[model samples]
Target: MRHVKDVTFHLLTHEDAVELLQFERAERAWFEQHIEARPECFYTLQGVAKHIIDCLALNAQRKMHPLIIRQRGVIVGRANLRNIADDHAWVGYRIAQGAGGRGVAQSALKHLLTEARCVYGVTQLEAVVAVDNAASQRVLAKGGFTAQKRLPGYSRVSGAPRDCWIFEYSPALSHGLAANNTLY
Candidate 1:
């Protein structure tokens, strides 16, 4: 694994709107290829501000946790644990196109898992990934999430029905982890 230095994942703040906008705009195309595209309004500063504000409000309510992934002070990605309830939440993450590989997704998943268990007291987490998105699938597996089942035509990617896999993190995965805390 490549050592990624100066990488940090922290709760989002109003001050992050500008950098977040830049990150989103820069990686929009890459992200859209795998996930649904964001609306045009989402590329604007005001839109980004509103997004941050909205997420912050939800965070305050403990309904969700939004985090900004940064590397050396620049926004590189975004991750969120949403729909938090009953000690469970949905995990979602996106890394900038330029920041792909170099273990960013794996690192971010680890950080989010840590926060889910530590800060949010969420014992279980789930993620839905497009069946063909192998990169994300590998990342989730590396983080101890096991595929539970496939949801046929569960999502629309690029306006077409797409199959998806439902993955849930298992505490047992932790027991099987090596001393370094990884399944491998």
Candidate 2:
């Protein structure tokens, strides 16, 4: 685990299944208010283990960076660099309801930015946020992501069709160059 302030990011592992399941179940309803709900099966231990296994498989294939976030050794969130390619990946995360407004998500996003940019050599990072999720929007902005566009009916949030904004992070923005030429 690597630490940023009091938060730590650990690569997802089989041993995390039980704890992660508990975190997910405990925050399921709260999370659904800002993101889509997971299928009922995902709330169980075995189901979580299976989900972890599947993510690990993607991880092994070099297509994802799946990590669990913690603060003082308690599960606070989960984040990832998924759909990874040569120099781009989609970033996503879920923070426990209790951790809201405590800088946890911002720290987690900062760590993910470091991981994606340094460890994975990913220069282009993308995040999709439900338009109504102002907390996450602020986190992304503070982390240097720029609004790209609105994706109409992108997905369901709280079981209702909601538009989303595609936010993007590119090192070029900091370097003041448009060299990243990768099409959005």
Candidate 3:
């Protein structure tokens, strides 16, 4: 587990299946608008159990870090550092509807950054945001992620292709280093 004060990030476990199912069920409509469509079973306990198992396996393989966000002892969201390779990982996050606008995602992400560097040995992080999700874009920017490019048809949402904005957070770049080893 990792945390920033009261907000905690916990690695996914089988015990979290029930809570995760409830969270996903509650946030289904809200989440579907911004993310790819989930399978019908994703909102059920069986699905969550399978998901936890898969996450644990991925963690053992050092290819993913799947976590849940907790504030005041209540699970509020989920985040992942996946596709780890070459000292980099892809980032993804989702906060419950009632949990938005409270800086929860940002704080959780700050903790995740530390874990990514120290625990996962990842030096770079990347996220893809739906073009219409301005709030998420702001959160990423506030976390020191810079927009890299616009990807056309980057993903499918509700079965339709959607464009997305790619953002990247580089620890070296944050320290003022240029790509060619020059200091800014």
Q: Point to the candidate with the largest lDDT.
A: 1
Off by over 4 Å in 1: 178-184
- Give the alpha carbon lDDT tens digit for every residue of 1-184 in model 3: 1133577888988988888898899899989989986899877788888889988999999999999999888889998999988789998899999888888887767767777888888878899998999989987776778888999999898889999999988875466432222211
Candidate number with the higher TM-score (2 or 3): 2
TM-score of each: 0.92, 0.90, 0.89
Candidate 1, residue 122: the lDDT equals: 86
Where does candidate 2 have its weakest 10-residue lDDT segment? 175-184
RMSD of each: 2.0, 4.7, 4.6
lDDT of 2 by residue, 52-113 (tens): 99999999998999999998899999999999999999999998988878888877777777
Clash count, one per candidate? 0, 0, 0
lDDT of 2 at 71: 87
lDDT of each: 0.85, 0.84, 0.83
Candidate 1 displacement at residue 77 in angstroms: 0.3
